[model samples]
Target: MSIAKRLASQTAIYGVSSIVGRVLNTLLVPLYTSRFVAAEYGIVTGLFAYVSFLNVLFTYGMETTYFRFANRPGTDRPELYNRVMTLLLLTSALFTAGLALLARPLMSLLALPPGHERYAVWIAFILGLDAVAAIPFARLRLENKARRFAVIRFANILMNVGLNLFFIVFCPDILSGKYLAGLRPLVEQLYDPSIGVGYVFLSNLAASAFTLVLLAPELLAVRFRLNLEPLRPLLRYAYPIMLMGLAGMVNETLDRILLPRWLPEGFYPGRSNLAAVGIYGACYKISILMNLVIQAFRYAAEPFFFAQSNEKNSPHTFALVLKWFTLCCAMLFVGVSINVELVARVFLQRPEYLEGLSVVPVLLLAQLFLGVYWNLSVWFKLTDKAYYGAYIGVAGAVLTIVLNFLLIPIIGYMGSALATLACYFMMAAICWWLGDRHFPVPYPVARLLIWLLVAVGVVAVSWWAPIGEGWGRYGFHALLTLGFVGLVAAVEGRRLKAL
Candidate 1:
């Protein structure tokens, strides 16, 4: 099979797990919004936002480091893998113990409500488990274990979803009932009717614990060792990537943390701060379709790019890949923008949440730019100038912090969305400019710009078109999607066929 075909197949398998898992996860939004108050869900949002940053800290860029070192011709791949796994195990253990010790003060610092410290502890555990699991997951990718990777990932997600439903849906009924009469008093003492939002974190903690059990195979396959000789070079390579990952997470999540602080005092009354955050988070989930695609592409693209480094036609391949990425992301922007009104309903159970609908396009396009920036970043990665990624990511983070500070005070959450879009655009433009100087590729710039313009035009038209609510809106979007796909096919059909 051609590289493109192989990539296509790998991406499809990865996408099935990622996109399908996310879609199933999306259903939790309605379940959450229905049962929990918006502010309560805001806690869920804030806590997870914190988890996102911690996840980056814990993984510390080892995935990319593994990819870089594991591909070296003289390397002992198994030894390298075991060394990294050992490092992760030690770090994860320390992290868990430290967090457990400091959970109360940490909770207080994050401004959790009274008696919510346990939630923070649970979240810390979740992140620690995920950190420990990172090496095993990366090993799956390293070994081209895409099928096993997908299955394990799918099973983990299913476990999360099932446990979530039990905690949020089934457990409530069981608790409310006078079951066996002996259990009623115990249940009443343990279960709080007002703890509606706490279940989100609790369920996640449970699922994380369950996932550790499933990773037993990946853990037992490799001997544990940490060799410092290889670690020196790996650390040098990984440190910049670590900075890049940390900055990247900040770019993605800092808004949720900052918005509550910067919003006008009493913006929405007592719970509205959290409610607004919850609404924003729900709308963001609708855009995960674009995120999943970009992610799947990266999973295939990185290893493929590294393996082809010495090929004479590698630059050409990278250039072609860049064009396809831009085209697909642009098409996704148009498709999601057109159909978002319908998509919003899937996540928001109440009309009040629909207030966040406008933020969806901004968030979606921000993610698209993010994907483009990532695709264009291969130059630095392959050449081991990963520091440049750090530079670009830091620049983006500064932009994010400044813009969010300025705008959140004025426009509330929408300002955060706009700030994110601007930040990602800046990063993409900067990365492309820098990458050309180091590793030039003859990207199809003119064609890519044409497609972007077409997307803009399509979005404008779709907005003005009087598509009624419900099925009519979806139908209109479906038609627009078809039109965009047709244009792409017509323009790129021959190129694809030749490949």
Candidate 2:
């Protein structure tokens, strides 16, 4: 099979896990918005923002590092996997222990409500288990076990979703009446209505633990030996990536983290900062379609890029991939932005959450730039200049922090959204300029710009056009989407046929 076809196939398999699973997971948004108030849901959002940050630390870039070393000609794949696993196991255990010990203090720092420190404990376990699972998951990717990988991933999401439904939906029935009176004790023990959003974290913890159990075969496949020789080189390559991952997460999540504390207090006299955060978080889910695609592409692209690193036409291939990726992202941006209101109405249970709908377009565009940056980053990874990746990430994080602090007080959560857009655009542009100096992929910049302009123009027209709120509006948006798709197909058809 052709390399492009192989990459597309792998992406489809990984998409089964990422895109499908995340879309299912998105179903929980309504449940969350319905069950909890903005402030309550904000707690879930804020804590998970921390989860994203700590996950980077826990895994410490070892997943990519494992791929880097494993693909080298002389490397012993199993031994390398064992070595990485051993290191991850030790670090995960140590980090979880330390976090558990400091749970109260950390929760206090995060300004959690009193008696809610247990969130820190549950999140600690979730992050640790996920961290340890990182190596095994990467091994599956490296070994080309995409089907097995998708199954395990799907199972974890299924388990999490099932438990969430049981606790949130059914347990309340048992508690409210005598329908399941015999199981009241068990239900009461397991479910605390006052704890509200805590069940989300608890469900995640259960799922992560279950995933570890499912991965037992891979866990036990390697002997328990901590070989320092291989680990030294691995760490050398990985440490920079760890730094980059940490900073990249800051760019990705720090806005949510900072929003609660930074919003002006007097704006909503009775409402807490989390109220604003909750609305923003709920609306942010509107961009999940874009993020889901980026994730699936990254999952497949990372390994594929590494495998193609030594090929003669690798640069040309990378350039082609970027052009097509940009085209797809542009189409997605138009589709989501034009139909933002429909998505908001369909997915969100509370009308109050719709206040932040205006931010969706900006966030979708931000994620598009983020996807482009990920594509451009292949240069640094391929050329062993991974430190350059760190440089770009840190620059973006600093930009994120500075912008959030400056903007949140003025424009509210919109400032945070704008900051994200600015950060990713700058990162993508910088990576492209720097990447040209080192790796020189012939990215189709003019064509990509034109595609982006067409997408933005079409969405703008749809947004401003005086259309009624019936089938006419829906049909208009549908036509716009189809027109964009048809144009892309017509333009790229000749190129694809040449391939």
Candidate 3:
């Protein structure tokens, strides 16, 4: 098989974990948006953004370090694993304890809804559990244990989704004596209506704990030995990576973090700032369709990039990867944007979420730029110029913060969406420029930009299409989406086949 084809197969396998599992989780979006109003659901959205930040803090690049050192010739893999887990265990324990102790204070500072203070403590455990599981999950990846990884991931997602349905959907019905009358008394004993949005956090915590239990075998085998010799070098190698990951997370999620605090009270008329946040966050899920694809591609592409770094045709192969990857995303970018009204209706349960629906296309385009940036990132990763990634990510995070603060109050979430688009667009541009000088890949820039332009034009055309929201709109969109696919196939059939 050609190198590119091999990478494609690997991506498909890895995607079973990411795509399918996340789709299942994504299906619950309707339940949350439908059951809870924007203000209530915003709590789930806002708190998770903080959890994402602290998650990076807890893991701190050890996962990547484990894969690096464990893969070395004649390295003591088991010993290395134990040491990494020991560091994680210690740090996570301290952090979780600290967060639990400061839960009430954090609740106050975050301006969490009254009586929802326990969310701080719940988030701490979720972070702690996920953090310790990081190295083991990394170990699975390094060992090429893809199926094992997929199974564990699916198990966690299923458990989480199931609990969410039970808590958010079925429990309420049971309480109202509408369904499963026999279970009303039992659910009454366990479920609390006041726990309303808290179930989201509780469900997530249960899943995290369940995930850790599934990974317990990885833990059980560890010796808990802390050899200081390797620990110093590991931390040295890891801290920079930690910085990059933390910065990148800020770019990805800081908007959700900022939207509630930054939005003005009169922003959405009757809606509070938190309500505006809820709307932005819910609409953001539609854009995640693009992110899910990027994530699956990344899991397969990262190792492939490193492995092919020394090949004679590596640059050309890398270029082809970016070409096809960009083409796929451009098609998706157009498809999702054109049919988004239908998508919003299907995926979102509240019309309130539709207010910020304009953000979906912008975010989709941002994720497209992000995918290109991911492809270009190979330059730094392969050339051992990791500092460039750190620099670009930190710069992007700074831009995101500045743009968000300047834009949210003026344009609401559109400002946040545009900030994300601008941040990633800049990151991709800078990465491509630096990459040409350092690890030059002959990426078909002109062609890729044309695809993006065409995609934008098509999306714009769909927006202006006089066909109202009827079967006529659906049919018109289907033609445009399918027409784009056919165009790509007809134009690039031979080239795509050659790749």
Per-residue lDDT of model 1, residues 1-499, tens digit only = 9878987888888876787876787688888877776777777888788888878888888889999999989999889888988888888888877877887886665567678877877877888888888778877887888888778777877888887886677667777663455665666676666656667777777777777787798888778787788688888998899999989988999998887778887775554676788878778777777898888788777788888888999889988888878888888898888877777667778776777888888888899889889988999999999999999999999999999999998888999999999999899989989988999987776778778878878987888877677777777779988999898999888987887
| Residue lDDT tens for model 2, 117-217 | 89999999999999999999999999899999899999999999998889887899789884878999899898879877788999999999999998999
Number of the predicted model whose lDDT against the real structure is largest: 2
Error of 1 at 499 (Å): 3.0
| Ranking of all predicted structures according to lDDT, beginning with the best and ending with the worst | 2, 3, 1
Kindly give the stretch of ten consecutive residues in candidate 3 with the minimal lDDT sum.
64-73
Root-mean-square deviation of candidate 2: 1.7
lDDT of each: 0.82, 0.90, 0.87
TM agreement with the true structure for every prediction: 0.93, 0.96, 0.96
| Model 3: pairs clashing at backbone N, Cα or C within 3 Å | none
